[model samples]
Target: MPSNVPTFTDLLAGAKRSAVHLEMRDTYYSNPRFESWRQGHCVDWNDRASWWRPFHQEIADAVARGVTVRRARVVSEPVTEYIRWEHYVTHANVTAGEQVRWLPRRLASDLLLPGNDFWVFDDTSVEIHHFSGDGDSIEDEILSDPKLIELCASGFERIWERAIPHEQYEIH
Candidate 1:
């Protein structure tokens, strides 16, 4: 697959099963569309300053609607800002019981934590090509060539195997 080619959506829809590979980059929620998606039942790999409120809202909404949300973090600068806002503006709904897989940073640690949900691979450094609808060529491109998805899924599994279970995480 060409690096410049777009295949994410087709890969997602074509996926009989899917694993999401994500990274926590800065400025993720600024996009309106991304915000709308965040409003739905989704999992994120985020270590941003402004992510918690929306994240909390999304988690609460998902839980209310009977959806499971999981998260993972690997030591980005501590979310001091998010913590302050969370403490002052909203009551914390994410309790210690909620499972969040934590991993070390040699590999893609963030991607490993959230399993079975849509992988929001935050490769913000690279230009992400998005595909829409059932374009025959695009479907053929991803289905016939499963390398992209396989590589992503394998990466997630590898890190997942080595990660610490979020059950042990202390809520502060």
Candidate 2:
């Protein structure tokens, strides 16, 4: 694996058409924000300053430049506590002009999902992320292979089609 892989911002920064992210984890091991939420620290969306982060602003800026950003999360039906908390913070994503959707794992049973989560940029390249059993991000691989890109993009489209929009999805 090459150590010069592009970060999410790196990929998005060069995206001219679209950016789609696919997330398939129920819980992540090394996410500080998730840990904070797990420990009862919720983002007060009402407070404008509290929820504004550099990453969110980056998404907003991308949208402003007409780059369509979309995210799809395939989660368990009986949502995990972490998923529930994630749902609450999704407001920031929407505010950043990124489209988000949630699909229950049951609904994805027939789908050919990827083994790892990924972000596809303009259907040209993919940032495939590897996670440990405990959900720690182990590594991210960037690929420009046609077959891999096709699989990831098509998989994301399938999930997005069956997922409920953020505004309509209710946590379990």
Best by lDDT: 2
| lDDT of each residue in 15-55, candidate 2, tens digit only | 89899999999987747787787788878778979879999
Q: Show model 2 residue runs off by greater than 4 Å.
A: 1-4
Best by TM-score: 2
Q: Which portions of model 1 show Cα errors greater than 4 Å?
A: 1-21, 26-72, 77-99, 106-145, 170-172
After superposing all C-alphas onto the true structure, candidate 1 shows an RMSD in angstroms of: 11.9
Instruction: Give every collision pair in model 1.
Output: 20-119
